[model samples]
Target: MKILLTAINSKYIHSNLAVRYLKAFTKDLDCECTIKEFSINDRIEKIFEKIIEEKPNVVAFSCYIWNIEYVVKLSNLIKILDEKIEILYGGPEVSYDGEKFLSQNPGEYLIVEEGEETFRDFIEWKLGIGNLKINNIKGLYYKNEKEISFDGERKPMDLNKTVFPYEKDDELHNKIVYYESSRGCPFKCKYCLSSTTHGVRFMDVSRVKKELQFFIDKGVKLIKFVDRTFNCNHRFSMDIWKFLIDAKTDATFHFEISADILTDEEINLLNTAPKGRIQLEVGVQTTNNEILKNIDRNIKFEDIKEKVLRLEKNRNIKQHLDLIGGLPGETFDMFKKSFNDVYSIAPEEVQLGFLKLLKGSSMRFETEKWGMVYSPYAPYEILSTDSISYDEILKLKRTEEVVDKYYNSQKFGNILKYFMPKFESPFDFFFKLGTYFKNKGYLDRNISSADYYRIFMDFTEEILNENTEILSEIIKYDYLKFNKKKWLPTFLNRVVEKDIHKKIRTELKKENIEDVHVERFDIDILKYEICGEIVKDTKYVIFDENNEDNIKYFE
Candidate 1:
């Protein structure tokens, strides 16, 4: 019988590690199992039609919060088309609500938590290759004549026994390949699903190194560690990181780490990594200790700040920091302070995510105590809490949008630096900017990056009443430095010395002025950008993003 293992990812770039692991773990069963991957952004009907075309005898879905709804809809459609085709549900989403999920959905079996061995055994039994029937297998919940029957929880697999998920890199090209050298999380952060599973298990360090080497040898573009807290075990983590650093692999390895717990040795080792070889994602959800305490996150803001700033000083690694909006003890004002607190570090990306009361997470059970109202859907995003209103949450959502467009884009870096000082706080600036965009209907639809620049100009000059002349020149400098086109924005003062452009082009042995980009700005934008020093005088600047020595300033 043909078995199809499927995954519906939240995005095109994300490959589901669970499905890969399950397939690899059970590969010895010798079933004709195939894997299908699609994005949640894909239409459900289209996905349904594609699955029907596969014409498999068994269909198994790897489910998660982001794609559960789509899986449910697709599974229903598949059942309608062919009831003879057996269905199976696995992954964290269905694992937590196994009985409930099986009762409501078109699935005969729910492979509960830690699915490797469970799935292996089930496939063997279903194919009559193994005598151990479905009921006796731990971690298997099956339909007993319209009633869901469950066996006890299965032991977490010896991670070493877990086979390397990929034999070849053909399908994973350009996708973010996920690797799990370890499973489970040590900390009990109430809002997170990891808190549901206790303790951490790791594969053999040598084995992990060998697997990672496989990715490096295959020239994987990016590998993200699915380890909840990558550095929970010092020696194990250090060994792997050292291997990655010394191997000098071109792949970029991303990790979510607890910055507060980092030691000097760890910091120093991380500092030595080749630039772009390592990237960190730190979860500083809030600076409010009460909120952190409520979530059982034992971290001091000061400690995290000190540790993160030390990493920042290195300037070798790209850091992405996180901030959550709605929490039990954090009010709107508290979140404002939290936003500003995280903003002070100015990491490469600031993810302002709202609280999601995931099904199995502890915080989901205590929503009433916190007066938290959330969506009753798959994602279950917090609508509001006693501390924050829905309207305020909506505003923060808009603010998040503007932050992604401007702050995260890194294109408006120079312009933001110039304008931020006039504002009260970074939070104040972004919130107002978000509101402004909302008021102008800019956030409602797609707008080009050039349009964003023009809108920013309007906000700076018209609303802030700042000197348009200085702002325009700064924007022009930024635009030229970041953009390729020789043309300047129409709103900006494009008046340049024709003689200087021609002289510079000739000096570079170019036949036309457009062949080489050299602009004379009214102010030394680069000097001002590098430091607070305002030259307030004309200077010529070259623009080429690809060149190592692109932004050369000439007097």
Candidate 2:
């Protein structure tokens, strides 16, 4: 029998492990299985065309918020094309609503929990044996006309029974590396799906070492751990960390961790981790005690600070901190405090995210109590309600972009740090910039980075020109460009000669008369957004006679 299993990922870097598990189980079981992968932006009809072309005997889909709608629509179309093909659905999305979903749709099967052994049995029964009974398969939710039935529960599979991420396929070896050191999460955060995965289960240390050796031998460049809280079990986490350190693998491993649970021993172990080998992403959600309590996130503010400082002080690890905007009782001012506290640590990246209320999470069950209003769509991303207005959420969304470009991208933090003391805090400064960007109609606008940089510089000029004292704090610079050299920040301090012609001549080592050229500006063409008028001295595109295409324009 031929089986096709796939997951629609939000991005190619986030491919699913479900397909890998299925491939491992079916390899030696005398079954032919293939996987078709696509990103979220890929068209559904195109995938259906491919499926029709393949004409597989059985089609199984891995469902999640990012790809459920597309999968469901395609599955229905496949049924219409050929009613005989067996359809199966599994993943976190269908794990909760499998019964309802299967009952509503006539000819679909739902596999709950881990699907390796059960799916293997299903394939063997269908392909080899005739008229075989299948009611005994564990963790399967089968639906009749009006009722849904479930088989006996299945125990979690031992990680030792599985293959490493890159062991199954050659394409997956060097192109991508995604593995999990542990399963389940200890904390019961309301908005997360990890809580539903139950208690933590760590893969054997020796097995993980073997996998790391394979990855190193293959020269994989990137490895991402899907573990919910990598630092939860101190011994398990530390043992892996020490092994990776001793192994001295060349690949970079990224781990999501709880900052407050970090121990002194773990800190020492992390210190031994080679520079650029590990990157840590700490989810700090919110600093407000009331909001944290409402969401059942057990973290103390002081401990968060202390732990973050310890991690940040180590130059070996790159730190990424995150904050969610639309949580219960988290006011704008309260969020500002959260931002300020996190900004004080100065992480390499600071991500401002909006809350997502997944279907199976505790937050979805208590949305009414929290006054949460979310989009009635497959993803169900939260929009603001009574506690947080839609307008405030919109502002937060823009704030997230500015944070991405300026803070997270590490482009403007050096300059923005100077304004931290002048404004109330870093959050206040970025919030005001977000409002400015929105007011200028650039929030959702599709503008190039070069154009946006010019526009931002124009705004900064106006703000600084209003108060020259700000100049004492922040550096004023312009990008220098040429055929041999590209645009690079040239500090104002570098140009002691005030005259433009003299400065150009001195910098380029050319005569003033030869370096200078007379240029004309169509006075009516310089559109300035802040002043709402045209400037007679300059035009939209300033070009040099030597290089006609070399020009920059701003709002």
Which candidate wins on lDDT?
1
Against the reference, the lDDT scores of all candidates come to 0.86, 0.73
lDDT of predicted model 2 = 0.73
In terms of TM-score, how similar is model 1 to the real structure? 0.96
Give TM per candidate. 0.96, 0.82
Model 2 poorest ten-residue lDDT run: 476-485
Tens-digit lDDT track for model 2 on 209-287? 7787777777788888889999999888888888777875678888999989899999888988888888899999888
Model 1 misses residue 346 by how many Å? 1.9
Q: Summarize candidate 1's per-residue lDDT along 1-555 as a digit string, tens digits.
A: 778899999999989888888888888776887899999889888888888899998899998889888888888888887899889999888888888889988878888888889888888887888578888889988999978898789988788888888987457678999988889999999999999887899999998888888888888889999899999898887888888899857789999999988888899999999888999999999998878999999988889999999999878888999999898968999999998888888898899999999978999889889999999987899999999999999999999998987888877888888778889999899999999999999888888767878887789767887667777877877677667656777787776688877777777664332444677788878788888566778787776546624677644
Q: How does model 1 fare in lDDT?
A: 0.86
Cα TM-score of candidate 2: 0.82
Model number with the top TM-score: 1
Could you give the C-alpha RMSD of every candidate to the true structure, in order shown? 2.0, 8.3
